[model samples]
Target: MQVAYDYEYQLAVADYWQGRPTMEPNVWVPSLPLQMTVAVPASNTDLVVSSGGQQELKLAVMEESTEYQHERSNPMEDFEKAARAFEDDLQKMQTKMHLFPPSMKGEELSKYSEPKVVSIGPYHHGKGEAIPQMESTKYAAACHFINESGRSVEEVYGAVFAVADEARRCYDADKLRLLSDNDFKPMMFYDGCFLLQYMLFMCRDNNDEDHPIADLPWVVVDKLMKLMPKPGLDMETFVGRVKQCLQTRRHLKFDPPILDESYKPPHLLGLLRFYIVGSTDSSTTDDGSGQGLSDNAKKVSLSVSVIELAEMGIRLTADKTTAEINKMRVTRGWFTGKLFLPPVSLDDANARFLVNMAAFELCITPDFGEVDDTMSTVCAYLCLLGMVTDNDTDVQELRKKHILQGGGLTNEDALELFTGLEKHLRPGNCYYNTIVAIENYRSDRRLWIKLYRFGYRNQTAIIAVLTTIAGIAGFLGTLKSFQ
Candidate 1:
């Protein structure tokens, strides 16, 4: 009998050999009378089948294909999972209080960026050697805060616990895996209450006998005061005072607008950043047309130093309109230009405050949509200061214009601080616009600036030449008269 090898026959054969029943009963035979003889040759084995007469049968060898097929999966489901993960990451980035980035992790930068007296959020909490000393203070402040609110401790703590899960999402998951809800809830509650009480203590008169500050150690008070505003000031004045103390404002001539009652901050440091940088609305600059700069406008670059600007007939002045960092701009006249900068007072406290704020900005992901500017307002302001200040002489010039106010920092210190900070700052829209305006002014008066810079550089030689020429003309006139 001759058998044709086909797909069905191959499948049947495979199923029979594998001990699997075939789907078609008629296709498989359980018992068939047959005789088979196998012959082993040098190159291959041969099988001969004989019923009445012997017949030789040859087996065809098949090569296996090296391809594979996987089970089908739902693409939409995978896409949705990926999209959800991406959104979660963005939310975490926006709401989370982040630690200093690797770039800002050196001993010098970390000293200011990390909390020295106390840790406010999960990022720094329980990590520092000195932080444990403030645990008692936090408890005391929480107790005071609860009493001041006229709420029971359980009620206040329950409120924090209710939002505890939401708050936990703001911190890194790896850091929080070891922290249980039992430990985390109290942390948020105590930290929140302590921060509120601290702010209240800073803004109100300190004579209250039951105040948290009264119980705090003198060393702690001194350190805390460095990060806080002076006591006995109203809310607006308190904001301005803190802004000045932190060197957040170019000048404290104008008070910041009162924080809205509806506004909520992520943490204590966030609240301080708000007080320093002001609201996003206040930070947004308005051109005469009430529109922001075009993309092209924000790409402009400025390289001139403060001294070079002065030589080009451009002077630095403090912006008295507002304490917002975005208030920086340049104005031009027919013969001169003026760069208006927000005034700032630099000191140890201010340096710490500024560095922390800059680090906060650095930690924030650009996808947060917190502001239209490409960089944070504080960082942009620092970058602008860095651009104009190259040396101690530039700091002196800034002080002369009252743009740099009196602080514990000397001119050299201020220069070093700005130089250290500006490297970490990316240009924001405000800084870029200021640069655009300055560049435009420089370009418009290119010829005049060039001539002025040349004349200014060679002024002594030019004056000496003029004096010699005058003497030569006078002697020639005298000689002619004698002749």
Candidate 2:
């Protein structure tokens, strides 16, 4: 793609313009016009099952991925979003819009960092007197005031946002420096250009010898804010959008959306990027249109993603489960390949086989994604309705009520329960969106117990059956006799 010939070079008399037949003289170098690309790194999983104890359950996280590897490298913020907010306010103020009754000079804006510039604002921020744990609430209240009354020069007593506008008139950057020098904290900035705009406002308000503005990271905030939405709307939605904006740069991003996608947290690009990737091997592709993917691949991918989620959720529920099982500490027992489940964790995750099955079973079972709570529920439900391929012995023992706690049921038991619950578990009955059905059977609990419970695939099948039956009946009456 280098310049083969420069038509301009031929027409130009100057030697400087001499080049290939139809390109500029500088066009033939070690580069091409930049093109976009998606970046994907391979997945890595390390597994260990210990008997006496888990020697290496802990693994440190990887370093942050900064790869700009995207199909499009658009900056998170467009041009207009990067423009200063308060500075825009200042311009209007000069035209008698009165953002301030008395104007603050550009030099006065620099002294905002002084520490001595403390506040006893128009309202008590609480206490006789140091405020505690009420920053965001107070900040929001102040913002509302500024939006309403900052324009009215005649207004003296008003909300913090309006008065804050006037406070900026006497701002000093030096006082902000004292706040930073003394290590003042709880200093957060709005995500986008608001940080710089806020900085200018604070700098102009220096009624002290210290500068709090010096401590805030205006530059980094400035960079990130471009992608952030304007603040007039809701905070919750805005936070989620900021997360997605940064996540557009991650490696694990997939085109196909998952049924149960993880919630993207605000500004955590690192974790969000890793969330979407599946552990399944993509290096090789099978035409899995008919029979679907091999069992091994499904297990591997599902296990990794699910385990990642469980690790987050288990903090409250699984701590006891882990501690109870760990007491046995059968290191040598691990080689025998038995993953025994407590009656509790079994129900919690529906006894996923990888964790409970022996190494011998592990060899037979495909490496699906980690046994997440949802997947386990789905699997357990299938086993109950006889949809799962086979029966399990340990589960049967539970259904027999041999355990300390009862309410255990087998797959058939679950089916009967769901069938009995048809009316009770219908659309707004037991839950939202989830279809109630009995997937498996437990010996102790009555079948009706599961009638109002949830099932994913079974309900889907039920809908499909009804649709098919309706179609068949409609067509049968229309056919000619023996035709």
Predicted candidate 1 versus true structure: per-residue lDDT over 42-91, tens digit per residue: 54445777786777766655655555244567999999999999887766
lDDT of 2 by residue, 138-244 (tens): 33432333233232211211122222333323223443433321112112211122233333333332211111112222223333333233553232332233222
Give me the displacement of residue 80 in model 2, in angstroms.
29
Which candidate ranks first by lDDT, i.e. highest?
Answer: 1
Evaluated with TM-score, which candidate comes out highest? Answer: 1
Which parts of model 2 are misplaced by more than 4 Å? 1-320, 323-335, 342-389, 392-394, 398-405, 408-411, 414-483
Identify the runs in model 1 with alpha carbons over 4 angstroms from their true place: 1-80, 127-129, 205-241, 244-256, 261-264, 278-302, 365-371, 410-412, 462-483
- Cα shift from native, residue 469, model 1 (Å): 8.6
Query: TM-scores for all candidates?
Result: 0.67, 0.15
* CA RMSD per model (angstroms): 22.2, 31.9
